[model samples]
Target: MSQRKRGPFVSVQLMSRWRNIVGLNVGMGEFLHKYPHVFELFVHPLRRNLCCKITQRMRDLIDEEEKIVKEYEPELLQKVKKLLMMSKNGTLHVHALRLIRRELGLPEDFRDSILRTHSKDFRLVDLEIVELVDRNESLAKAEVEKWREKEYVDKWLSEFETSYAFPINFPTGFKIEGGYREKLKSWQRLPYLKPYESKEVLRVCTCGGIERFEKRAVGIIHELLSLTVEKMLEVDRLAHFRKDFAIEINVCELLLKHPGIFYICTKGSTQTVFLREAYSKGCLALPNPIYVVRRKMLDLILLGHRNTRSLEDLEEIKEERNGSVFRTNVGGRRDGDWIVPILDSYDQNAFGSLGDINDSKQPFDGCESGRN
Candidate 1:
């Protein structure tokens, strides 16, 4: 026969034998009930002479019957059998076994044996163990659900954290550093403001501001005015020993980390006092153009102007107005302000120059300023 065919036959035989043993024990109990007094007569030794041959056969059959019953109910049968085996062969054991069977309504042969040997204490112990196991399983299930919920929250936080910090990848074997600060200062026409990097190695942004240092410095400076709050988050985790990158963060947890610059990039939003709080902690305040443009004309005045006009062309007009020699044309022509004369200089490294402020490497200039 094939292997698969032989497997089924083997299983059937095993199952049949198992059921037969179970049935044999049940049959023995029925037979003993038919003549309960016969087992009681064994209590009298004088009756032994009346049943010499029959007693030996009966004892052997009872042992086999108990074994069959034990196949299904081993724990219960072992208690009964132990009590019977240790008992005397005559009247005392017989009477004791008989009282247990009749009073407990157990099998005549099994009850007497069970009453003699069963442990009341051990049964109580097993019940307690079962209760403890049930409680432990319930607690473990609740804990697992709690951990899953916490894991979801952590994953959400990680996404925000990773996106805030700028991470850049560069081509292998390519090195570019050291000269960027000089390059930026020259392009911005800020000769005195040399790059004082706090760290030896600079982490460059993929924005390519460092790469296009010589080409379009002026456009770079203008683009810095329009950075979004989301974009600024890319540089929040940047590690800088010199000047930290300015970023506007929405998450409250980040505020506790001693942010270098707390920027409010929303347009037309009232955040002046909020910026001042951060400034008091040595953090720079960066407000977007919407807020900067609305402040009173006096608020737009800046002290540092190497030339007649600023990048906004609003600070250099001098005229005799109301008996005071004050600068006019501060914000725009709408205020009847004169156009400030643009300073002229060729050396890109000059402290303040029209050409250099318009340079390419210093694109991020004038976007963020500290509160007075």
Candidate 2:
């Protein structure tokens, strides 16, 4: 990382020292060797280990990309504002934010740059809590109430307002069983409630609104995902709030049952549920400020000296990219573009093993309260 006089951009002597500083599995030397455009690796006179330095062009590119993120500061503020408004209070735990920091493309100094800069709209109240300054937008729009409004008008022609049904962006190529669509329609017709309202009230109207619980659950999921940069999250992250959110003990069954609104992906060695509506064509409909920075990094990774890649390959990656998971790589299906195949209770998260999968068809009991 240091300069050497009358030598390459980086001093060769420092290469051996860098290996100790690098905390990643990939050695710093190997990492530099992989990206020739970004760095020039060579052996030093005093040291046998290779030394490297950033190319001037790479430095310029990095600075230019940083400018883009700074330019998009307002857009990122909107994302943070929306997240805080949907939290349990007006505040959110900083740790929760850190978990998806990379995927969201949040800056290392997100608090200093974005949050503190806009003190009128956001505040750091309790050291760890980021609270919203004021509430402006409705909670229903937290997901996509407008889409619901259109659907309700088209389907039931209901005049009542404050009634927003979440729109389902079903993964392409998914089969709609004869009764499934009707059930979703029925579920959609159920009344929409605020975050604080009792689940018991939904029952007064439903008469056994097991379906009512499902719709409410979808809204809760929508609220949770709205806080995230990507409208998706690991099921375990929200496990503690299952009771407060009115979700079932084993949410997989509930999420699996409603294939349209929620998509349960069992990739990345952990199960994650995505709100299908937030994404358009497998990319985040909304972009975080760090998105451009990540894209630039993507260019470097896709085109490495060790493994050269074509423009077509990068374009393909761009086309199918969404959230943290690469749709094309993880799913690896050609039946339909961004097609999300509904895995029945047979999936690993849904059932314990293949033997249990056979019993999956035997109606899962309504063990969860209110689901009955």
Candidate 3:
């Protein structure tokens, strides 16, 4: 809806055209009506036909998210640069990046704004690929390396274990069968090549054993998720880079196998993989400006129509809609100053484990399990 240039509202007939694409099992009108807090339904002033638009509050949240993205362009640029450096050939397909652009906190015009403006740092090849011109050795460090260093120094873990260990954060209620802990500990102690290390070295080391090869694949995925703004990505989107990253194992199975390090939410039309360590009770362990803005949007969606408004509040919304600019308090804070509080509790049983690879599939509701 935000991408439409005609106006904020779209005709109900027009929106219905995308019902199949959006995977709506019910009528578009019905679905829109269900979320009255997020979508406002009204007759078009000129056309005199029913149309729908995101509520004023939702529009404000979207604008704020865009502003936050613009403010973090510099940091996002470095993140993209580092991602290209971590790639096997110092390049990433344009389409693959577009698939997760929002997760990476990139502006819509990043191609021209970031890549073209910084010609010294990036190059566009045949308009299909983004290649790094100069790889910065300093930026070559993977995020997991820092975690390993911290564990070695702060936690007093042995260098051998810390060097290859990943931070495990098993979801609450995750079942650990007998011998699983010992097996996990031994796997953690196994050495593997880092994601940012040379591919030639990784190729030579993989010949030693399948365990080392799989562990290296895990490190690659861990580094990839850490580079994202949300620390999550669609499972299918990750498959697009399997050949590029040399992940021979089925991506879904690999994630399912390591319940502690990653969580796959099998909710909605797509499967999403979340880095467990990056989240605490469903909220980001470390929130950034962009993430905070997005969280505000989520809070608004969750608010639904249950949020009661007095006459004064309705009048203020009307005045704002009529272009009478003024600040108003929402939930005891000024609209511009509002920050959604982190959720205190979540469903412990929302997360389901396969128990073992041989175990039967279990119901998983990632949305309820991962609050953010």
Candidate 4:
């Protein structure tokens, strides 16, 4: 992720600047030709720079997905409400918030919605900050308490708990040292802290109470991951909020300490973390409409990648009765026409490995394409 935020859409030339993340080993010009369906090239009318944009089909899918999110607005509202309550004085700057809005399935005008629709819970202050109208400090801790109570009952079956402990399918050969067994035992015994609970005296943190900070940190991180479409986020993005959200300086260590709740994966060059409890068998156990839509979007890219259609063939493709695109069979390539259904292509086991973006295959190894 860029340290300085950029919009979801970027000029193809600008994207070329970061070859690593975009998976462009060869020049972008060649790579662009290979995935014309995923990326469409157009000249900026004013700047006259030839740029690439996500296809209209992608924007349509997103529109449908946002509708689903709006349907679940009550759930997402409580989510944002809890986050604002977590902050001091129950306020958060809108600028810092814009980063995770998409992942959280929140609308760009969320601040305004909070005032207009959920006026009882939140308010906008000075057009710059979102403030809580009614603070529910125990909100997060209550959730922790419920989960803790349930897990404690399961603790009697130590063997089952150990064997099935929020399964983390780390990439091959990452050994778990023998001490892991002992550590798991102790970690399970640690108490859950209330988000608003104050700490008196502790030997843990130099910042007054170490345990308190950890509890608060976990609460914030938990809230963030919970709101995301995939209960996972780039660790660097979370680190960006270390000071803003009072997260620990050594965030990796903090997350590692709670293996039952979080898992840090180095699947990509950049580290990402997943909320283990939110996943079961490599897929989201509780996928809402937003995840459903995102999975469809992923299918579109994966499908196009797995089975390429020549540009000449797609050029002849025509619109159908519905807005969905359907590619006609050409040159004995694919069988008949298939509508790109929004819910067509999700693997049940895809999320079993800590929310893998592409469960079917590893990310493209080489960036450049043979195109052009």
Top TM-score prediction, candidate number: 3
Task: Give per-residue CA lDDT, model 4, range 29-137, as digits (tens).
Answer: 6777666556777766667777776666667787888788778888778777766755645677776667677777788777666445787787777766777787665
The segments of candidate 2 whose C-alpha lies over 4 angstroms from its true place after superposition are 1-40, 44-48, 52-65, 116-118, 137-140, 149-162, 169-178, 194-214, 223-254, 278-293, 305-372
Q: Please give the distance, in angstroms, between residue 134's alpha carbon in candidate 2 and its true position after superposition.
A: 3.3
lDDT of 3 at 290: 74
Q: Residue-wise lDDT of candidate 2 within 1-372, one digit each (tens)?
A: 333452445554555466657554575566676776567566665665566766554566677666866776666677666656544466776656666554344666887777778889888877667787887664325445654455456555454422645544343335555786556555555675544343455546445555655656666666667656556777777564464344565777777766555666665357777765455433445645344344444544445663334323333443323443332342222224432232211111222110111112211111121111
Candidate 1 lDDT for residue 255: 24
TM-score each candidate. 0.13, 0.59, 0.81, 0.62
Backbone N/Cα/C clashes per model:
16, 0, 0, 12
When 2 and 4 are scored with TM-score, the better candidate is: 4
Clashing pairs in 3: none
Better of 1 and 2 by lDDT: 2
Task: Give me candidate 3's TM-score against the actual structure.
Answer: 0.81
Stretches of candidate 4 exceeding 4 Å from the true structure? 1-28, 40-56, 115-119, 137-143, 152-183, 196-212, 267-269, 305-372
Where is model 1 more than 4 Å wrong at Cα? 1-250, 263-372
lDDT of 3 by residue, 308-335 (tens): 5532254232112232222223332222
Instruction: Evaluate residue 338 in candidate 3 and report its C-alpha lDDT on the 0 to 100 scale.
Output: 31
Best by lDDT: 3
| Ranking of all predicted structures according to lDDT, beginning with the best and ending with the worst | 3, 4, 2, 1
Overall local distance difference test of candidate 2: 0.53
Ranking of models by TM-score: 3, 4, 2, 1
